[model samples]
Each structure stands twice: as structure tokens, then as C-alpha cells.
Target: MLSGLQRDSFEYSIHNANPVNGLVRDKSRDGWPASIAAVGLALAAYPIGVERGLMTRDDAVKRTLTTLRFFATAPHGPEPDATGYKGFYYHFLDMHPGRRAWRCELSSVDTALLLAGMLAAAAWLRYDTADENEIRKLADALYRRTDWQWMQHGEATVSHGWTPEKGFLLYRWCGYDEALILYLLGLGSPTYPLPAESYRAWASTYRWKKIYGIEFLYAGPLFIHQLSHLWVDFRGIHDEFMRQHDLDYFENSRRATFVQQQYAIRNPREFEHYDELCWGITASDRPGPRTLLVDGIQRAFHDYIARGVPFVRRLQTKKEPTWRGGRGLTSR
Candidate 1:
């Protein structure tokens, strides 16, 4: 079952990709732009496609080359329609034009996701052939070109992203969230590595709380605990925070999942058809934002929101609390 799912997911990436530019569609919808992160993920998935006999190595090579070549040659400037600025891409790009889409900020987290995919491809496509060698070269060039320190914008913590319009985003990636890949990549970058203190600063913001007799680093969204795991093997590795806690991120993720499970088992909100067997709450699309009477309680519901458990300490009298537009509520 799991293998079939994996194969289907990979095929989605393959089929949705633009043939000429190699950009992958963000999602199947009306005129949705290509996502750089999706492109990066597609790059990484190509190797797995080869290993599983789902794709020919030559095909993977072609896809990788086309994608990397487009990115390497894409225009970079402060213009509103530029491909990117400072070597980081916008969250979305036009499918055909391959330029910035939606005028979105140059997303740090999405760019990290993309780079993770790129490095994965570079590591896998190891052959003496000219095309494979070019893949490695392009991957190295792209990674090195990313100015991590520049993205920091003179802050100890990395900014969430930047906009050509307003400059650095107000949000910094304080941890226990999906920004793990962003911080790790910035710290590990050879050309523009972040200071070790940056990681420390980010980790210091983590909140630890115990609920339902289970203690873990408190993050509302389940994906917060899982997104970083995609590129990172947290087992047997300890950051300063993990070392102090006597556990690593892998164990932390396990606890977070358990917390979600317990929350579902309790069904406090009385969401329709929620139980231990049917439990998963990620940032997802739904109807729209409004108040709803669920189980005779007035609950505020939202569309396309990152829903998670109520904040441990931050929640006062409110049933759900959103910190800086973080997340809210459970899902069915």
C-alpha cells in the first residue's frame, strides 16, 4: 500500500512538470503557478524514480538538467517580475514564463526545501558521463550561489523571507516548526554559512509543555514535527536543545504524533468523524473562515489554515489561539 502511494506521488511530480522548463506545478488547479519547492522535490524524487524502476536514468537526467539549467540561467534582479533575487526563488513561479508568480516573497523555507531536493539529486546522479557531471556542477553552483547571510538581513535569526517591495519579512524562523530545513541549510552552507549562534537563537524560542501526561516540545501543527524529517535524519543526532532535553528530533516527532493521536481520541471539539483511526491535522484547504456551531459550541473555523492543538501556555480563555497567524482548531 505504502509503495503504491509513493509511486503515485512520484508520478504526480513527473506528469505535472512542464516539459520544456522542467518546473513542476504547485498543485492541480486552474492556472496554478509552478512551485520552486515542488521543482526541488521533483528533482530529489527523480533519483527514487530511477531506483524503483519507475523512470529511466536517462529520463531522470534530462529532467534534472532542464530544471537546473533553467534555474541557473533565470534572471535575477530587484524587478517585480525577475526570476529571483539574491539566489533565492519566490514561493511560486509562472509555469511558462518561469518568473515570479503572485508577486510572492522570496520564500526561505521553500527555497530550503528546493535546495534539499537539489542536493539529493546531485548526490545521486554520480556518473562520469557529461550530463551527470553537468548535473553535479549545476547543483554545486546553485547551492553555493545562495547567500544565506544575505537572507539573514543583519539579524541573528533568519528572516522568514523577503519581498522586493517591502524588503525583509517581519517573521523570523524561531523553531519547533517547518523552518528546520531552512536553518539547517543556512548553517551548513559553505559559501554563506550562518553563525552557530543563529541556531542557538532559534532553538531558544522553542516551548516545552506536557499535556495528557505526554511531554514534548510544543508545536501545534503535526507537519511542524514532520516536514524537517523529510530531508533530515534526526536519529542519533542531537542539537543543543535536544541534548539538553535528553532526546533527539526523531523522538520529538514521535511524541508530537502521539499528542495528535491523543487529541483525536478525546475528540474534545466533536469534529465530525474524528477518532484514533481517523486523525491527521495539517495545514489544509477547507470551506472558508467563519464561526460554526459544532456540538453546540461556537467554534471559529477557517479555510486553508494550519490547524493544530491549542497552544499549551498561550491559550487563555479562548478555545483556539493564533499567534502571529500561526494555526487553529482540529480537523475531521
Candidate 2:
């Protein structure tokens, strides 16, 4: 059952990707622009398809090469319509023209996700064949061309994104969220490596707390704990923060998962259908945007939002959070 579900989910992105440019749509439903993050995920999914005998290795190579070639050849400049700037692609790209779409920012985190996918393809396609060698070369070039230090915006930490109109967004990835990949990529870059203190700056905003008897690093959304794990194996790898706590990120995610399950079991907010079985509250679809009376209580719900627990809510109420946009906590 699980394998079937996985196959379906993987194929959804893989099948929806634009054949010409290799960009994947944000979702299969709407006529949305291609999400660079989804494209990254599609890159990662092709290898799995090959491994499972769902696709030929040559086909996977073609798909990966298409994506890397698009990124490598796409126009990158400071212009608003440019596909990317400073080696980071825009958050969304036009499916037809393969240009920047929706006037989105040049996202650091999204680019990291794309790079993760590229690196995965490079690692998987390790043959002396011309296509395999080209994949590795493109992946290395993509990573090297990104000016990580320039994205710092003269700060120790990296900025969230840069808009052609607004310059750098007034946001830094300080707190514990999905930016782990961004920081790690920046730190590991040979050409434009950020300072080691940048990673420390990111970790400094982490909020550790015990919720439902499980102590773990707090990032309200479940995706934050899961996305980085998709590429890097955090098992037994100790960074400065992990060394202090004597727990690796893998264990931290395990505890976080447990805490999420416990929160659903507890159902403190008393939301409708929030039992143990129906407890997944990450970025997902909701019923609607109306306030409904559930058990005589007025409960608000959102439409297509990133819902998270109130762990960071407590922290924000006590002190001002570092990230300007505030943690992505959906109000119930």
C-alpha cells in the first residue's frame, strides 16, 4: 500500500513536468507556474523510478539532462524577467517560455532544493558515459556558480530572497525551518562559501522545548524537519548544536514526529477531525476559509495553508522572533 502511494506521488510530479524545459508545476490541479522546488523534487524522483524498474536509466538521464541544461542555459541577470540571478533560479518559472514566472523572488532555499536534486542526479548517474559525465559537470557548475556570499546581504546569515524591484527581502533564515539545506549548501560551496558563523547564526535561533513529553527542536511545520533529511543523512552526524545536545538531527526528527503525533492525540485546539489518525497538519489543503462552529466552539480554518502546532507560538509571545515574517503558524 505504501509503495503504491509512493509511486503515485512520485509519478504525479514526474509526469507533470514540462518535457521541453523540465520544470515541474507547483501542483497538478491548477494552471500554476512551474515551482523550482517541485522541479528539484522531480529530479530526485527520476532516479527512484529507474531503481524500481519503472523507467529506463537512459530515460532518467534524459530527464535530468533536460533540467540541468535548462538551468545552465537559462538567461540569468538582474532583470525582472531573467530566469535567475546569481545562479539561483526564481521561485517559479513559466511552463511555456521557461522564463521567470509570477514575478517571484530569486529564492535561496528553493535554489538549494534544486541543487539538492541536481546533486542527487550527479551521484546516481555515476557512469563514464557522455550523458553521465555531463550531468556531473552541470551539477558542479550549478553549485559553484551560485554566489552564496553575495546572498548574505552583508550579514552573517543569508537573506531569504531578492526581488528585482525590492532588492533583498527583509528576511533572514535565522530560526530553525527548512533553510538547513540552504546554509549547508552555502557553507560547503567552494567558490562562494559563506562563513562558518553563518551556520551558527542559523542555529542560534533554534527553540528547544518539551511537548507532550518529547523534547525536540521546534519548527512548527513538519516539512521543515523532513525536507533536509530528503538529501542529507543526518544520522550520527553532529554539528555544534547537535554536539551540545548529544543528539543528531535524525533522532531530533524522530522525536519531532512523535511530538506531532502526540499533539494530534491531545488535540489541544479541539479542531474537527484532529484525532490520532487524522493528525497530519503540515502544508496541505483545508476545507475552506470560513469560521465554523465545531462542538459549539468557533474554529477558524484556512484554505491551502501551512498549518503547524503552537510550539513556536509560545516562544514568539515571550520574545520577538528573529525572522521578520514570523514563523509559519496557521491560526486555528
Candidate 3:
């Protein structure tokens, strides 16, 4: 179930890359993290099934090995083709961009996530694909490249995946120790040293308890999922504080779901289909300026995916913008 977090993140990436709205531009290549996450989930989840005697360990091993090999050598192939892109290997085709650009990026995060998956696959299934060494190298790179600039405070309010700050949160409290270690040892992230401090800041940083509730969709699953289960101990402690404050898992998840609706983003399956499909930002129980910035992000990604590539051009002439929406009452 937690694996679905990365899956949803990838889906967001792919949907943004979709022809209906080409918002990601050349960055459409970033969809690889989802693909890798998918294969990894399959690889990791299947073993649990094997352990339960639902499938043979041999079958699980064969499947995992096949998947990893496929991921390492697939072609980018044609765009908007659901089959290849939807399939096991081709999904990650455009994942890496030659060199790092932004200090904090999906590049490093995805690399760490993918290599973490690979490492899990290696340890769990003991399967070594040709890309095993490559995976190790990528993991090493992820650890080597910890630009704190990528770390931000209170960013999970957005409808995307985890930020570095939240990444640290996942490390500290979620019950997933293996996944946390993946984010740490695999990426060589310096996050562990600051885990206690980072989590403390997050727990007490906000006066608005509602905002704390809003981050659950992204933060909760990022560490709790099979791919990243290293945050459990830290999450346990965090959970105690939340429970004391009445911010348990269910409540936080609800707020995050509400935020998603306001932003017009889809909810994870567990949030309830009737609520997800019919629920809109305009819905009564969900009425408010849900997450207005989410729409702005949507608009941006839509342009990137549709346009050939993004260019930050200087405007030939300055243009003024006008504001719209219900006006708020001014205070005396």
C-alpha cells in the first residue's frame, strides 16, 4: 500500500507529461522514478507473497531479476505510447538527465529511491542483474549529492511527493527502518544526523495544526511504504505526539485528501472512490481555497509537457496581471 506513494508520484509525473497537457517539457524524462518504483514494488511485494507461501521464492526471484534487467537497458522509444511506457522497463527510459542541475531535485531523489529499490531487491531476493553495479553507483551518487538547498520547510503542503524536509521526517518517525536507511546509507544522505532535530522542528514549528494534518498524503507514505520503511521508529515517536494532539493517522490523511480536492488533484485509492471522483474543490464539506497553488503547478507542468521544451524567456513587453476570486473582509 505504501508502495502506492511512489506510484502516485510517478502517475502525477506521467499525467503531467501526457499530451492532454504537456507541462513538464523536456523534463518528461523524469517519469523514470515511477517506473522504477513500480518494478521495485512488484519485486518487493511479491516476496512477501512468497514468504506467505502464496508463490514460490523461485518465482519471485525469477520475476525480480527479469524486472531489474529490463529496467537497466530499455529504450526511450516513442512518446505517448502507453504500452512501452506502461510496461515494466520502458517506464524509466527518460529518468536521468546527463548532469545534475538544480541543487535539490527529483534526479537525486529518484536515483536514491531507485537504487534503494535495487538494493532491497538484491538483499531480499538476492538477485543480481547487470545493472546491480550501476544501481550501486547511482546509490553512491545519491548519498554524495546532498545539497541542503533542496531541503525546504513546510513544502508538503503542495500536491507533489516528499521534499527533503519531509524526507527527513520519514527517516525519523516512520516504522520503515530499511527504507530510511536506503534514503540515508544508499544516498549517503547526511539526513540522519539531523533527523532528530529536523523532526522536532517539524512537530513544533507550526502554530497551525491543520497544516500539519495537510502533509500526511505525501509524508506518510514516503517512508511507510515497502520501498522506504526505515522511518518507523521515528514515526512511532512522532505518532505519540500527534496522538496526544489528536492528529492521528486518519485525521492527517483526511486533511491531506481535502487539500488534494481543493487543488483538483486525484486521491490515492484508499481515500474512497466516491469521494475522489465526485469530490471537487467546490464541494461543501471540502469548500475553501483548498490549495490554489496546486492549480498554478498544474498549469506550469501542463505547459512543459505540451511544449517541446521550456525556455525562460524575457518578455518583450511587461504585462500586468489582475486578481480574481471572492474578496476577503479587511480587518480594522
Candidate 4:
């Protein structure tokens, strides 16, 4: 059942990609724009499709080449309609013209996600063929062109995004989120590397808490625990933060999964349909943007939003300040 569902989801993205630009739509519904993150996932899925006999090796190579070529030669500038600026593509792109869509911000994390897919393709499709060599070169060029330093905004951590009209967003990726890949890629970049202190700054903002007796890094959303793990294997890897805790990130994510399950079992909020089996709360599509009363209960839902739980409890106490104006607290 799970494999079937996964195949279905992968096929949806593969079939929906714009043939000319190779960009994947954010959603299947009408008027949806291209999601760079989805494009990244689509790139990663091509190899899997080949392995599973879902697509021919030749077809996968052709699709991958099309994607890399478009990104390599796409118009990049500060203009609103440009494909991207500073090697960071817009969050959403128009499907037909392959231009920036909806005046969205140039996202750091989305670019990192897209790069992760490109790197994955380069790793999996390693061959002596000219096309395969070009894939590797294109991946390297795409990653090298990104200016990680420019996104720092004079802060230890990277800013979330930048806009033509408003400049950089005020929000920095401070606390635990899916931005781990963003920092790791920026730190490891050969052409435009960020300082190691930036990683330290990001780690210092982490809040470790014991939720329902499962202690781990506190990130409210499940995707935060899953997204970075998709590309990099954190098993047996010890960074400064992990070494201090004596627990690698893989174990941290394991504990987080357990905590999510326990939180649902506890049912603190008493929301309906939340249990051990049906307890994933992340950014996803939903039915409506309206509040509906069911069984004499007032329930509020969202359309497409980043839904999360309160894993770390913020307390008002005078303590040494951490980055991003966040108060220091360990538990709820």
C-alpha cells in the first residue's frame, strides 16, 4: 500500500512537469505555479523511477538533462519576471514562460532543496557518457553560482528570503526547521561558503526538551525532521551540537517521531481524528479555509499552511539571550 502511494505521488510530479522548462507544478489543481521544491523532489525521483522500472533509463536521463539545461541557461536578473536572481530561483515560477510567478520571494531553503535534488541526480547518474558528464557539470555550476554570503544579511544565520521591493525578510532561520540543509549546503559550498560560525549560531538556537518523556531537538513540524534526512544521512554523524548531546541527528529524529506519536496519544488539544495511526501534522493541503462545527465542536482548519505543534515551551525569564530575539526555555 505504501509503495503504491509513493509511486502514485512520484508519477504525478513526473507527468505534470512542464516539458519546455522541466519545472514541476506546486499542486495538481488549476492555476498552480511551479514549485522549485517540487522540481527538486522530481529530480530526485527520476533515479528511483528508473530503479523501479517505472521509467526507462533513457527517458530519465532526457528529463534530467532538460531540467539542468533550463536552469543553466534561464534568464537570471533582478527583474520581477526573470527566472531567478543571484542563483536563487523564485519560490513559485510561471509554468509557460518559466518566469518568477506571483512576485514571490527568492527562497533560500527552496533553492537548497532544489540543489539537493540536483546533487542527488549527479551522484546517482555517474557515468562516462557525455550527457551524464554534463549533468554533473551543470549541477556543480548551479550550486557554485549561488551567493550564500549575500543572503546572510550581516547575521550569523541566513535570512529566509529576499524580495525586490522589500529587500530581505526580517525572519531568519533561527530555531529548528527544515533549514538545516540550507546551512549545511551554504557551509560546504566551495565558491561561496559561509563562515563556520553561522552553523554554530544556528545550533545555539536549538531548544532541547523532554516531551512525554521523549527528549530531542524541538521542532514542531514532522517535515523539519524528514526533509533534511531525505538528502543527507545523519546516522553516526556528530556535529558540535550532536556531540554535546551525545546523540546524532538520526536519533534525534527518531525521538521526535516517537514524541509526535505520544503527543497524539495524549491528545492534549482533544482534536478529532488524531491518534497513533493518523497523527502527521506538517505543511499540507486541506479541504477548506472555513470553520465548521462537527458534533457540537468548533474546529478551525486551513487551506495550505505550515501547521505545527508546540513542542518547545517559551517562558518569560531573564536569562542569557539566544539569537533571533528568542527567549531561553527548555520545556513547556
**What lDDT does the true structure give each of the candidates?**
0.83, 0.84, 0.35, 0.84
Give the Å error, residue 185, model 2: 0.8
Give the better candidate number (1 or 2) by TM-score. 2
Candidate 1 Cα RMSD after full superposition onto the native fold (Å): 3.7
Query: Best-fitting candidate, measured by TM-score?
Result: 4
Against the true structure, what is each candidate's TM-score?
0.90, 0.91, 0.35, 0.91
Off by over 4 Å in 1: 291-299, 310-332
Give me the overall lDDT of model 2.
0.84
Which pairs clash in model 2?
Answer: none
Candidate 4 lDDT tens digits, 1-332: 98898789879877789878789999898888999999999999899999987888888888899999999998898887888889898999988788888889999999999999999998999989999999999999999999999999898899999999899999898878899999999999999898999988988888887656677888777889999998999999998878989999999999888877876876665677889997876775776576788788776666655356532233323431112223322343
List the candidate 2 regions with Cα displacement exceeding 4 Å.
286-289, 293-297, 303-305, 311-332
What are the clash counts of all predictions, listed in order?
A: 0, 0, 32, 0
RMSD list, candidates in order:
3.7, 4.0, 14.0, 4.2
Write down the lDDT that model 4 would get.
Answer: 0.84
Candidate 2's displacement at residue 6, Å, is 0.8
User: Lowest summed lDDT over 10 consecutive residues: which window, candidate 2?
Assistant: 315-324
